[model samples]
Target: MKPVFFIAFLFFSISSIVAQPTQKPLLHGKNWMAITGKPLAATAGAAIFQKGGNAVDAACAMLAATCTMWDVLSWGGETQALIYNPKTKKVIAINAMGVAPTGATVDFFKKKGYSFPPEYGPLAATTPGTPGGICLMLANYGTKSLKEVLEPAMQLAAGYPIEAQTANSIERNKTRIKEWPYSRKTFLTRPGEKREAPEAGEIFIQKDLLTTLNKMVEAEQQALQQKKGRKDAIMAAYDRFYKGDIAQEFVRGCQEQGGLITLQDLANWKPIEEEALQTNYKGIDVYKMQSWTQGPSLLQALNILENFDLKKMGYNSSQYIHTVYQAMNLSFADRDFYYGDPYMPPVEPIKGLLSKDYAKQRAALINPNQNDPAMGPGDPYPFENKTNTYLELLKKRSFSTDSSDRQFMPTHDIRTGNSFNTSTDELYQDRLWRGTTSVEAADKDGWVVSITPSGGWLPACIAGNTGVGMSQRMQSFVLDEIINPFNVVAPGKRPRVTLTPSLALKGGKPFLSFAVQGGDTQEQNLLQFFLNMVEFDMTVQQATEAANFNSNQLWLSLGGTKMEDRKPRTGSILLNDNTKEATRSELKKMGYTLSFDDRTSGPINAIYFDWKHGSLWGGSSNHGEDYGIGW
Candidate 1:
């Protein structure tokens, strides 16, 4: 062969022989590690670890930083977390999700001509939760003081180099931001200029937010000086935020903007710490948050998926995708109908939903040949040996297929056969794949934490001088009984949220801790990530970079001002562009309307406990700006 041709041939052969590599390198550590949505926030967590804090303390630091950075969430948003305590040898769930305020009933919204909760503004808010959540986690689990944990966030609030992602989001949503006086004052650095938001790399300072953090730290300091214990001191700061001056200012600002929250509502709200739900996948015990957050659906899907030989089907194969999609659809159907605030009336049938027998019954309904678009919530009440009190009501509930017209209320969108409406498709997609930041941390002391905290994203309704953004979580509730008797809108009820964190334990030791961004796609991507690690033997980094698909066959848990906007698209699937053409063809033949993306592995972040090597291996995907630090 000619010399030039031979050289070209050698290069081609080498490229073809080598396996594809991950965009981000795998992280390795011996003592501890921290991972989150942004570089600075991850650095914040790392700082806490360096200061000798445990995983819980580091996780709190990361959470505060992410909220401060406006990385698709804020301090007023809800926080859902799963923490593995080394001493207790157990995983615990932190339910810091806020409740609806007084006058936030179905009748109140209907009277105002709203089909569902408004997508944005004061009307959509639940009482602030993240502030209380941080205090609770720090008080009960963390070894650090509130002053120590809030240091990084307070610094960021004072001023930090803003990234283009958040800066540009503010610019784009400036019109909405202007509607709220405090938001306009905090976000619009240049009132009349063409570029009102902080420029990328510009120092973005939030004086009001900084003041709030200072007040919290001051309250803690005062309590400590008075000889209060660490936990008691933390609770003192919590009280200041909820029942003291902070709460008064927050309520005044909220009501000024036509919101429903009251001082009583703020005082009544408190974070709950409960036993985390778990399911044994093979010999590994997987843990998730409770049903109120669409978390147990992942467990339910795991149970249904347990019936299949997933490894035999091959990862991302047509058969694998089909079976997984069917399982998720079934799990989500039950979630839409039965999951609700357990603290209120109409107790959720959680025991039944998590039952293996119920999973088997759900699994039996899946069609091997194609998608079953008419699947509805199963009768799990029977599995628990109790009569389904709402069988008649469930019967009255409308069921629709890909081409059927359906309605739960007079204002619900009326479908007209399979003539797919394209006008609102973009908005629908936005809600399905909406973004949120994830936090994961672990230490050699055997502490592990995974959290998927969200709400109060860009265009937030800033609550007065407090500088706290109001949560837009009310949209997750239904206004009608027939649609979801359990999830109906009512004062003080928590909505069924999409934020879910995951952890797995093997042989009574930490195995893996993981979480992802994206609304309804949260569980879908997490399931695939877990399977890649457990069944396919992929490394944590490789699993995060692997291709994953999303199903739009379930109702959206975020956004959408009307039922029409939240409606599910039967048989719609989002496939990674790397998907095999053969697999796509097979799915298309089975009644799926497919879409494609190059990045679908969740922008996921994870930590794998390499017990064999006695070390921690971290994974951060290339899909987004997720970063991790290890030492």
Candidate 2:
């Protein structure tokens, strides 16, 4: 997509709309901005920027650090990113998502008595993607050496002070971690004691993980010593991880633990850099990753919302919430059925799916009065000159219209939402990322990056001495065509994932780089976050902290192995506890079964380019470990 700059009039930057103070102070930077899931991780990005590396380099640093800390992800998880390369003046999607390995198929899962892939263990893993993701980004767009970018992560692995959130999670899941001997040895510092996991502030060390990172760095160094070009040297490291001893150990460990990945699977897996999917909303070009991720759902949401007068609706007003929720329900409904591995597909009618005519058609189906419990995927085939052959399958779909209060939601009320509630949050999280994390970075050179990486999380099973946790992304695949033919488990095909990173451009320049973490709830929060800045004029920080609502009107992308467990809870809405009682009552009247949580802030992180001021505005969510550093 060409940069649609030279709009008749320029959109104003963040202004008085953010009159209310945000919980986190706005971070301003004239040269660089770095933000992610943890303070240390962000700091790692900052260090890279200080070292004169570009946005891609800093983001790679942050990715490595978060994975090392198991900040909702591990080395073996997936990485999906959207980067604005100023030199190219284009948004590029990094499809670092791994594919289901050999022997991973619907029949394989069914015979194992699973309706879906298991939530954890080797069975739930696809090939690891983060290592390749990091190497690729660094080699292509970054000026830094792999050795430099990995230094922070390597340091973290050698024994960084562990935080309470992660430490406690390890303690709580010790039983499950114990099931994997390698994991037990690494995570459970005191196997037989009351607390097998390390305590808060303890210097948690991963000797094996450090060694693994060192090996990759060594590979890069060896290639460099041989006079290899920077990119080739990084690829050398990439090859070592995927085709050398690393892949061998990972395969041996995986098969030993009942997983399907073969060394061939690791060798064959490669990351793709493609043009980002785009849609114009009021002249701003918004970009998202491909269908393999849920990113496009946000693009579709924006298309539908474009037809509404959101500014007049007022932020969080019953009408606003209802309209936005309905739009997302429409978008996610389509995402559930149609989004999948675009590389393999019953070719997802993506061209048709993003067509304005199709968006208008979907928008027209939204009722202004109440939630549409029967919301399902729309046929985009006609827009692309193909008759939809799966309309019959869509009709056979099932969802709950009961609107009953789910005991599960209320339990995740204020306390659960404020901080990580190990049990349900862990489940809700990869359930990731029903478990995942986000990374955002930008530099004065116009380079910007947004990444939502997920998969291997706490209680993660280790892959032998590789110190890498296997990915649970395989759980994202469906076993039956009735659920999603495009997303059914198949060897060498990617599981449709919840990870998405977004970028927006106005007047032919980078306007925003942002992403968030939450399983299926990703696009819902991102859609609102974007509107908060564009429609409501909230500052990036204000938008990041603003209360948002979630709709559970689509099939969950993560969770259990049973079809019933992944079923949609129609008309169920998660509202911030701070919502006015009247607003809550009105939503209730609109057929929404409201659940309250104080922190629906997305744990969102973002960098907004204020061209007029020639500065970067950074925003990190007011909850969890999300943090940012700007300079």
Candidate 3:
């Protein structure tokens, strides 16, 4: 061969090898890493790992950077996390969700004669929880000093570009931005000029945020010099932000703006530490955050799915999609009616609802061809058929049934009956359903991570000052008598959140860590991702890129502009061959109102450890406006 031809051949061969997908290695010994919504946040964590910090340290660094860069997502907002240590094989759960101030009362809202508002301003604010959560994580798990971990975030905040994501988020919330002075000053360049969009590589700066972080670092150092333990020092740092100088200013601003938060509320606030909610799905150990939000709802959805043969039923078949929608509807109804702060009252026994036996029973209620408009909660224990007795009891309760037109169900004619089903003998089978046998082993190295961050979109826009904007979060519902349908309407009552962060393990080895950002779609998106990974056997990227779907079955009232009476939401279901033939037709036959949009589902940040390859693969969703991955 000619010399040039030989060189070209070599280059082409090398490129082909690099282009093929490679298995990620399992991170043995100790691995430090972080995944966030912004590149700068990831950079901070990577910097910490390079400097000899562990996961906790990297998390702290990432927390600060995320707060600074993705102000709407982080800041003093609440956070939840799962942290695992390999040597000890222990996982701990952290609850960084915000709480209503003590002075909040439902009666107060009743007297005002107005219903609760859902905007994130002074009216929608809760006590900021991110500071406390970050501090606690560092105190319990970190070896790095506070100053060291926070330095990166502080520097980045001093001068970082407004990424396309942040700019878009800012523009979307422009009306709400006008509620707070600080938000207006920081985001809006002029009084009447349209907000500018930042180019991809442009650096955005927030001098005020840098100042806040610097003050926090200094206070932490001072506390350490006084011989306080790590926990105490961290607490002191939090106090500086919430109850010290910042607190006084924040309280005053809220008071002047007719908000309800008080100084004592800020000083008395503390992050709750709770046991993680756990379950086993087809042998894989699935873990999630508990009540006050929708964490348990995902478990309920999974449990319901387990009762059905998803793959055999065919992907997204009308029948399959209808079943899944029914499951979500049932779970969501339970979430709205029963889920609340555990401190106030015990949440309903959701675990039992998601149990295998329960799922089987629930599955039996499905009428594959028709819409069951108002399926009541199934009896907790209806195993033995009491036909006579059950009928008599039903008569006493004045039971009634009604048929509701289906919305969002697929049309049977959309796909020619192109069955992808292989015969039992020809079916490609691997140990896909081996069950999460090694999940317990993975738990040994697991960490419980929970984040419940809050922001004051409306209040901050109106307030203008950073300090003033921070106060609005605490003014949400605190009254016992207020009838706020969503959690955001009531002060101290937790917001109905879409803040699900999760981890999955196989064979006592760390498998994946994942999270996403969407107002009410967080847990729903997560449930789909989990199903895609386990049941569908998809790669991380494929699972994320796969068309996503969600149902408006539960909070039909909260569907906003997307709500429909006769059709199920369309775009929620992916239009793949498998789904088109199976889910779409079956669901249409069942009758559902559906609408379709080409919107990105949600952004999922994930780290997958491939034990077989001895490499770690990290990925972030490119769909939802603002996420990316790096080596």
Best by lDDT: 1
Over 4 Å off, model 3: 1-33, 168-176, 192-203, 376-493, 556-585, 599-601, 624-631
User: Candidate 1: where is the Cα deviation over 4 Å?
Assistant: 1-19, 399-434
lDDT of each: 0.86, 0.85, 0.55
Model 1, residue pairs in steric clash: none
Indicate the TM-score of model 3: 0.77
> For residues 1-631, what per-residue lDDT tens digits would candidate 3 score against the true structure?
6768856764554444334452332223234335554556667776776777766777777776666665444464567777666666545677777777654565655566534432345645566777778888888787687888898888877676665434554555567666555666776654676654344356666666666677778888899999998778877888887778766766676656555667887777777767777677887777777766577778877877777777554444465567676777667655654455665533345455556676677767766677666654454333333222223333343232223433221110011122234333111111110000000011113332323343432214322233223423333232221112234334455644545567666776667776765544566667777776676666666555555666645442221221123122322333333234444555566666554534323455566666776555555555422233233
lDDT per residue as tens, model 2, 1-631: 2233312112221234467888889999999999998889999999999989999999999999999999868999989888887887988888899999999978888988998988888898999999999888888899999999999999999999998767877877888898998999999998688878898799999999998999899999999999999999999999999999888998998889888899999999999988789999999999998899888899898889889988766778899999999999899889999999989968898999899999999999989998888888999999999999898888888654555443332111112344456665654432212236789999988899999998788779899988999888888899889889999889999989888889999999999888887777778888999999998888999999888888877787887566667777888988888899999889889988888776776678999999998999999877667889999
Please give the TM-score that candidate 2 achieves against the real structure.
Answer: 0.94
lDDT of candidate 1 over 1-631, digit per residue (tens): 6868856764553343234588899999999999998899999999999999999999999999999998778999999889898998999999999999999998899999988888789999999899998999889889999999999999999899998657766877899899999999999998999999899799999898898899999999999999999999999999999999999999999999999999999999999998888899889899998878888999999999999988766677799999999999999999889988888889889999999989998999989879987778889988888889988988887745453332211111111112224454533222222357899999999999999988788889999998899998898898987778888999999988888999999999999999987777788889999998888777899888888888877777765666666677788887788788999899999988887765667678999999989999999867657899999
Highest TM-score model number: 2
- RMSD for each of the candidates: 6.7, 5.2, 11.4
TM-score of each: 0.92, 0.94, 0.77
How do these models rank on TM-score, best leading?
A: 2, 1, 3
In candidate 2, how many Å is residue 213 off? 0.9
